[model samples]
Target: KKRYKAQPIVLAIPRGGVVVGYQVAKELGCPLDIIVPRKIGAPHDPEYAIGAVAQDGSMVLDQKVVKSLGISSSYLEEAKKREIEEIERRMKMYRKNLSEPQIVGKTAIIVDDGIATGSTIKAAILSVKKKNPALLVVAVPVGAPDSIAAIKTLIYDIVVLATSYSFAAGGQFSQNLVQTSDQEVIGLLQKASGPQ
Candidate 1:
């Protein structure tokens, strides 16, 4: 409230973030929505993210990683194309016929269950920044310390419940780590939006 003075809209990173962001939006009495950003991983090591791309084609690349690995422009372009397609698919599945909530001049709180490499969130932040929000904040349950530090310069504020140097994947911090389905995401988005 110190920053926004008004209720802020929450943009939940889908799959897992919907769960966390739903409660936040409910508690804040604000609208809840999503932003889909797909990670562009390394060639051989798919788990190692080199960058991420948003639904609008906005992107964030780890130049150091790309340069060290000698990642080619062709590969990056291909990966970005594929990731943008995925983001579009997910956005369609989640939002369906509903249009995205208006965030211009409003505080945007981007929430996720946790952060790992931070590639996805970074992409989400850059995408949201393009919309010209009043303030951009990242709220998560936990995150890797290095990942948190890496993204600190990009966002207005961060609210992380926990952080650790030895952090692994987000599932490790959860008691019941179920793979959230697209249907679940759709249901949550509908519930958050209420009757039209």
Candidate 2:
């Protein structure tokens, strides 16, 4: 609050990031929201992200990786279409009746559980950038050193608790690697948006 004159709003990347964002919003005494950015995984290895597509259809792709992997333009087009559909489904399930928070002229803090390749978070940042926030920040518990370094070039203010040299994935740091369900995301959003 003291750092920026503008109002701070927390925007979490669902479904794992919602839990972390809720806590951050609660601590900052600000409103919490979600940003949907679906990862465009590699053809053979689904876990390997070649790019990501945001809710507004904005995409961030690793062109070098795409070319190196020989991923066709048609493949990317199909992947984006499929991801956008999933984004729509998620927005419907998670947002429900809630309207998107007013981000223009406010401090938009994009929160995620952690960063691995930084594809998803990069897409989220691009989507939020269109809203014209006064300031953009990325907050996460942990992230890979290389990923965090790459992300640093995108945003000025980033709060990362830990950067691990041995970082394999975000879930590796957690005691429980269980996937956060749609129900859990809905519940957390409801709780955060409730009496404060």
Candidate 3:
């Protein structure tokens, strides 16, 4: 958007979006910030997310799945507590006092590395909507078809580079599907913050 002089602020979902968002911010010549959300996984299926917690202590859960799995409200509460603690800690480590960018009258774009179930992304969209931004865009390089379908109504705009109607998972399309480190994330964020 630099060609059009779009002075936008980028909010990246951490752990994965840090890397993906760094590229977008660098290209847009905008300031980069982070929005860390933790997936509250159900018991015995810790990788399966039942809900998500945002950095500001706001949370959203899949009530249907929660009920179907017989997961207790107290169980989710405990998970949310731990997730919020991490959010607070990450905010201090990431931005200190950056004033949580004002999205009410600005173009606020949310970025993520990939989407599988899209639960966390949906929660992120919902969390940002509360701030009443002038525009809300969900940008991702990759995502599962079903997850993307589930969230089609949650955002004002969606930008995706690659799409497959029969996607099995987010990583199946990637060749270098490996985990990224926190130090790498910090470095990328720092690089993107520069107006190069």
Candidate 4:
């Protein structure tokens, strides 16, 4: 609260982010929401995110990686289409009422457990910027040094608990980093919107 001197709407990058953003919203007595961004993976390397698409369908791609890997345009187009479909599905599943928070003219804080490739967060930031928030802030528990540095060029306000030069994985920071399920995400959103 002192940082901004005003309550900000917390937008979590869902699955894991919802967990962290929920607490932040509760602390400030502000609204909690989500921004779904799907990573566009490399062919045959689904875990490797070469790009990402936000819930609003805005995307950011690493042109260098795309050219180096010889990723075809057809592949990228198809992948984006598929990811967009999944994004819509997730939005319906996570936000049952289909109503999202009002962030225009309000400070918007994007929260996540950690940042890895930074593709997803980049996409989310771009998407949210279109809504014209008074300010945009990213809050994460930890992130890779290089990833965080590159992201710094995009958004000025960043709050990270830790930065590691040799960050292996987000799971490394947690004791039991289990795969976050859709049900868990739904529950958190519900609790946040519940009666005070």
Order the candidates by TM-score, highest first — what do you get? 2, 4, 1, 3
lDDT string, candidate 2, 17-69, tens digits? 99899999998999999999999999999779899999898899999999999
Residue 94 displacement in candidate 1 (angstroms): 0.7
Best by lDDT: 2
Report the C-alpha displacement of residue 2, candidate 3, in angstroms: 8.3
What range of 10 consecutive residues in model 2 has the weakest lDDT sum? 167-176
* RMSD in Å for model 2: 1.2
- Return the top candidate by TM-score: 2
**Residue 100 of candidate 2: its Cα lDDT?**
79
Candidate models: Cα lDDT each: 0.89, 0.91, 0.77, 0.89
Deviation in Å, model 3, residue 126 alpha carbon: 1.7
C-alpha TM-score for every candidate: 0.94, 0.95, 0.87, 0.94
The parts of candidate 3 lying over 4 Å away from their true place are 2-7, 96-99, 165-169
Higher-ranked by TM-score: 1 or 2: 2
Q: Point out the higher-scoring one by lDDT: 2 or 4.
A: 2
lDDT of 4 by residue, 31-125 (tens): 89899999999999998889999867789999999999999999998999999999999999999984887788888999998997889999999
RMSD of 3: 2.5
1 or 3, which is superior by lDDT? 1
- Tell me which residue pairs clash in candidate 4: none
lDDT of 1 by residue, 69-158 (tens): 999999999999998988887888899888978888899999998998898899999899999998899999999999999889998889
